[model samples]
Structure formats: C-alpha cells, structure tokens
Target: MDIQHGSGGTYRTLVDESPLSGLQWAVFVLCFLIMFLDGLDTVLIGFLAPYIGAEWKLAKGALTPVFTAGVVGLMIAGCMAGILADRVGRRPLLLAAVAVFGVANLATAYCASLEALVVLRFVTGLGLGAAMPCAVTLVSEYAPARRRAFVITSMYCGYTLGGAAVGWLTPIVAQQHGWRAMFVVGAVLPLALLPWLFWRLPESIGFLAERRRDRGAVAALLSRIVGRQVELPALPEQQKVEGNPLAIILSPAFRMRTGLLWLANGAGLLMTFTLINWLPSFLTFKHVPAQTASLSGASLQAGGAIGALLIGWLMDRFGSRKVVVGTYLGAAVASLLWIAVLDRSSAALLLMGFVAGVLVMGGQTGFQVLATSVYPVAARATGLSWMQSVGRLGGILGIQLAGMGIASDVDPISLLQALAIPALVAAVAAAFLHVTPRHVPGNAAVLKGG
Candidate 1:
C-alpha cells in the first residue's frame, strides 16, 4: 500500500519481515567499516611516534607541536564540514571525506622529513574529522527513534574494534617492515571501503527532505521502517525553509543547548585523546614493557564498547542528560581511583582502565545521542558537527597538557588526578542540561505553547 501526503508526495509500505531490512543492515555494516578505518588512521601516528622520532633524530618534545597541528586540522575540518554537510547532504560529504583521507594517508606514507609528515598528517586529520559527524548523523537519522542510541552505539563498536586491531597489527607490521608500513595499511583499508560507500550508502532521507523540500523521501523511509504507508503533515511554518543555515542553530532557541553540548563534547574528547595518545607512553615510563603497555591501552577501547552499550540502554530509560552527568561523575572517580590505587597494581590498573574506558568513552556516546535529539531536522548535522569540532579542540588541549605534564616534574599519578577535574566539570555541566521533551520547543516555548 502507498499513501500520499498533502504536499503531492507519496510513500510505499516496506515489507514487514524485519525491524530493519537486509539493506539497512548492509548500510550499518558499511558505516561501521568506514568508522573502523577512521579510528585506525587517527591513532596510527601515535603507534609510530617512537619509530619516527628515532629515525628523524628528533628530541623528545620537538614533535609535540606537530601532533597539535594535526588535531587543530581535525577540529577545523569537523566544524567546517558539519555545516557544509547540512547544506550539501550527508552522503556526498561522507564520500568526499573518505576519499580525501584515504589519499592523504597514501601521501603520508612517503613523507621523507618531519615537516612533510606534519603537513600530510594535518591534511589527513581534516578528512578524518569530517567523516565522524557525517557518519553519526546518517546512522542516527536512519535508525528508529526508540532504537537510535543502540544502533549508534553498536556502529561505534567497529571503531573500538578497529583500535584494537591496530594495536595488534601496527607492532607486527612495523617490526617486520617499518613504520611506513602502518601508513600503507591505513591508506589501503579506507580505499577498499570507499567503493562500497559510494555504491551502497543512501543519502539520509531526512536530510534530503530538508534540503529538497521533498516530503516523499522522508515518508518513503518512514514507511519502509514502519511497514505501512503513513501520511505526514506539512512542516509547520516555523520548521519551513530559511536561507541562512547558521542562523538556524544560532537562533535563541538553540543557543544554550548548543553551548552545553559543546562543553560536554570538549570534556569528553579531552579525556579520550589524553588516554589514547599518552597512556601507553605513561605506562612505558613506569617500567611496563612496550607490548604490555599497548595491550593495556586496548582496555580503554574495550571499556568504551561496554560503556557505549550500557549508556545507550540507560539513556533510553532515564534520559540523555542523566546518563551523561552520571558518566562524567563515574569517570572522575575512576580517574582518581586509577591514580591512587589502580596504577600501583597491574591487575587493578587493567580493571580500572576498563572501567575508565566505560565512563569516559560512554559519556561521548551519550553526548551524540543528546546532540541529535536536541536539534531539528533542518540543522541537526550542523549542530552535531559544531559540537564535535569544539570537542576536537578539547582533544588538542588534552594531548598537549599530558605532554607538558610529563615533561615537567608532575608525576604521572598526579597528572591523572588533575585530569579528573575536567571530568568533574563535565558532570556539573551535564546537570544543567535542560531535558526538553522530544520534539518540543525550547524552555520558553514549553511554557508559552502550553
């Protein structure tokens, strides 16, 4: 059966065999691979850092600025691409991002000097940064509202798994071949995924509706999932077209929520990158073997997977803000526990690392769910991108701060204790997040419309 909307748009009922069809599953799998490749590329540098430093005869702190440069590039890319995706459509932006990063990875493998590598890595980071928000927006839009968080968290399982894969792959490849082999692996994997993305990935139906003002696409997608054609009302005037894209997000309605999301993202990313980039090194400094340190670092990703799964269910039951605030508080306690207790005992440290992974990584997962729900269909991608971009800046600070803390006389345990401050701040911010009913207007609108 097919139903037509008042706006001369029609939707056909999808077959009812599954909650989501095989096609939807295929799209999810492809998206998972894209994110997996992205995760691998993003962390590839840290895995090769020691080798690069030795080969280039660089001093310990000399390469610090270069790492920061790449992160800055990622921040810029996420912010810029996010707004652009809302304008151009999610699928195209995602494809372009993958292609750009894949080629950049290839170029990076051949860089002969530190300067060249820095430039290439920065460019690579730009592409890497854009892919994430686009992927999140696409997956979130396709998923049923009730299941959105679960599907998103499940997709990111690919990312954590990819990180673990790299942890295992990079050492063996680097040992036999060289550091450059890692880049070669990074460059090739994404290229393989690009073909499937171009062929299989559907442009987000919701995104297409807002862009082309075609209610048909939205209705069709909804019909497919719901298993029966359903009429959709015309968009309210307030939800109608606007010329300026940024104006939509900057409107008074979204200002406070946007700021809160940015804070949440920043704190989350700071904690994430700090651990990814420096945790292994810190372990090495404390007399752990290199292999053991890398393996221990995997606990973070493992914890992230567990956290992502748990928080998604939690958010569905409790609310995004509650889950986020609680996650931050948990992360803070975990960080302190790691420093004061876990670090002294290897077995305890691994357990604590896993727990820290769940809380800190889980917080970001909750943030993504919150960001998608807060924004309207018209500006969702832009909102998500901006939040992610702001978070990337936090990641930059986290990486540099950890480096500086280590270079100075600050003990590793003390630095871990200090890092807990940001997590605590995030918890406080999460408390302030106004939990508006789904599809309701701003706090003012809640009262006025009521």
Candidate 2:
C-alpha cells in the first residue's frame, strides 16, 4: 500500500477510486441495524410499563423514577462511549455496547421486583445509549459529505420503523404470551446480530489514521472502495493534542457553536418528548379510545420517517441550519394546531400529529448530522455525545413538566401549548447558526504530506 498526504490535513487514501471506496454502504446498513435495535430496546420498557405496574400491584406513577433512571444511565453511557470512540475505535465501542445491552435486556425478563426491573433497565440503557452515537459517528465519517445529513437521517428511519414494529407486535405477543416475552425478544434480536457484526464490520479509516497504525489496512480498504489500486499518504507524526473533554468543547473557538447546538438540541428534544411521551394520554383525555390514541402516536412516527428523508434532502441543498430552523418553526405551528383544533371526529388532528412528528422528530435527527459535521474528527463523538447528553436532561425535564401539568388539572391543550415554547426557542437559536465549516488548526499538516 502506498501512502500520500493531501494539501490539507486531510489524509488521502492512495486508492484509485473515490473517497467512499470499500465499506461505505455496508457501514450504513450496520448503522441502520444498530439504530433499529436501539428503537426496539427503548420502546420495550414502555410497552411493558403497564404490565410491570399491574404485576407489582403498584400505582402508575411509581414507574416514573424507573424510567428516569434509565435515561440518566443512557446519558452517562453516551458521554463515556463517545470519548472512548475517539480514543479507541467506533466499531469496537459499538459492538461492546450492543452486547452489554443484549445481556441486560435478557436479565430484565427475570426481575422479581420493581427495584430489580429498574436496575436492569438502567443497565440495558447504558448499552442502548452508547450504540447510537458510535454508529452515528461511524456513518458520518464514511458518508459522502454532500449526502451526510441524508444518510444519517435515513439510518434513523430504522429507529422509527423499529418503534412501529414494537407497537404492532408487543400487544399481540404479550397478550398471547406474557410481558416478560418483550424483554426476551429484545435481548435475543440484538444478540443474534453480534456474530455478524464482529466478523464483517470494518473499522473507520479515519480512526485508523488517527492512531497512526493500520495505514496499510486503510490503503487496502480505500482501494477496494474506490475500485482500483491506490496509494495513501504517510501518517503525520504530530501527536494528537488530547485534553479534557469538557474543556475542549468549551474552548473559545468552539464555544459559540457548542452553545448554539446544545440549546437547539435541548429545545428540540424537549418538544419531542413532551409531545411523544404524553400525546397518547392527551388524546385519551380528548375522548379518543386508548387503542386509537396509541395508533395515532404510531402514525406520528410514520410521518417522522417521511420527514427524515425529506429533511435530509432539504438540508443537503439548502443547509443544515436552515432546515433545522424551518423544521422547528413548522413544529411550533403544528403544536398550536393540535392545541386549538384537535378533537374527536376531527381527522385533521391526525394530520397535525403527523406533521408534528416530521418536523420535531425529523429535525432532531438532523441535529445529529449537524453535530457530526461541526466538530473535528478527533472530538466528533465527544461533541455529539455531549450535545445528546445535555438534550436528554431537557427530555427529563420535559417529561416531568408534562406530568406535573397534566396532574395539576391543567387543560391538555394548554399543556401542549406550553410545550411549543421550546420549539419556538429552538427555531430562534437555529436561525442564528452559521453553516460554514470550521478548519482545524492542525489539519494543514495532514494535507501537505499527501
């Protein structure tokens, strides 16, 4: 394998083909699977929530802490995993996360008490949380820059599809069998994929270059992808400057971008969880049947699939910031529509819900793409994980706010209206974001060697 450095700090694979030479699409498929499993794992506990409460003879509210604990665990795991991905490799981190979650999910099947269940759920969440960022980072690095947002969004469609599958499958399976079957199902599905991933999955070429080892492997991989023999530049000997994760993010160069992304992500997640976590119950309050409300929420997810695809194209053409701001503005309008006009016998409510799903859920998916692009390769995973972790905190607060508002005898419409505020704020922050790519100070060295 021949190695050459390009004009910029970018390491060029001396492959005869394009940048996305060997493993791009395969990585995308793997990422999609990871996201799908994440979706399945996340919704499984919710599907079993009612059953667990009944089995334990506990009030409905008693499980709230259990759910919150899982979210907290996920947040922590995501941050840790992101840093690890930077230090180690995305593929290994991703596989480890999946394996950990798979085993923990199986353990959930045998929980004898609420405390046991909560502990198991928290443990499973750590794996669930870590897998997503690792997959996202891998895909982002491999995908063509012009289509990066689209590819990432397309990958997440797996998540919504998995959620829909759970919605349709859980009732039938649990009714015929038992609630424990859901966790068993979740555990088995991911475990089944482990061997395939371990044998076939490729490491990120960028990561290999960063480590200054495996240059030969990177050359070969690039040659295969590009469809011809190629040479790659020699690895730079400039030691990567490692620093405190939080301090790196907060440095003057990244401060504004980081703050803007954190706010946008937090607000977007707050709106999504507030509406998604409570929409079904809110619909039931409006005299819709329980099954109908559940199905309506599923319909919203269906809309999210469409939205993700559309938003990805729009972002590629217009710009990520533009798409994000526009999507949030749309979500705010949709929320107001649901608040003012949603009622029994009004089919328009379904449309409103669907649109809300597209804008809010889809926009949040776009944020992940934006985060990946904004940070340099060395800090990419950490940047994404930090943004998501901060957003998870907002999601927790949103859940609590919705719960308290509904419990206080507040009108459901007013409660949804309150949720729209965050979307509006996200829109404002997104509008202010500039989309020019930042040049890393040391990147020029990598390019010169080529």
TM-score of each: 0.88, 0.90
lDDT of 2 by residue, 248-306 (tens): 77787778778888888989888866665567666766677555565566666667777
Residue pairs with colliding backbones in model 1 are none
Cα shift from native, residue 408, model 2 (Å)? 3.0
Model number with the top TM-score? 2
- Candidate 2, run of 10 with poorest lDDT: 441-450
lDDT string, candidate 1, 323-438, tens digits: 78888988888887755553466766667667877898767788787777677656778888888888888999988888887778567767677768889888887777764233
Model 2 vs. true fold: TM: 0.90
lDDT for 292 (candidate 2): 58
Reference-based lDDT, each prediction: 0.74, 0.74
Ten residues in sequence with the least summed lDDT for candidate 1:
441-450
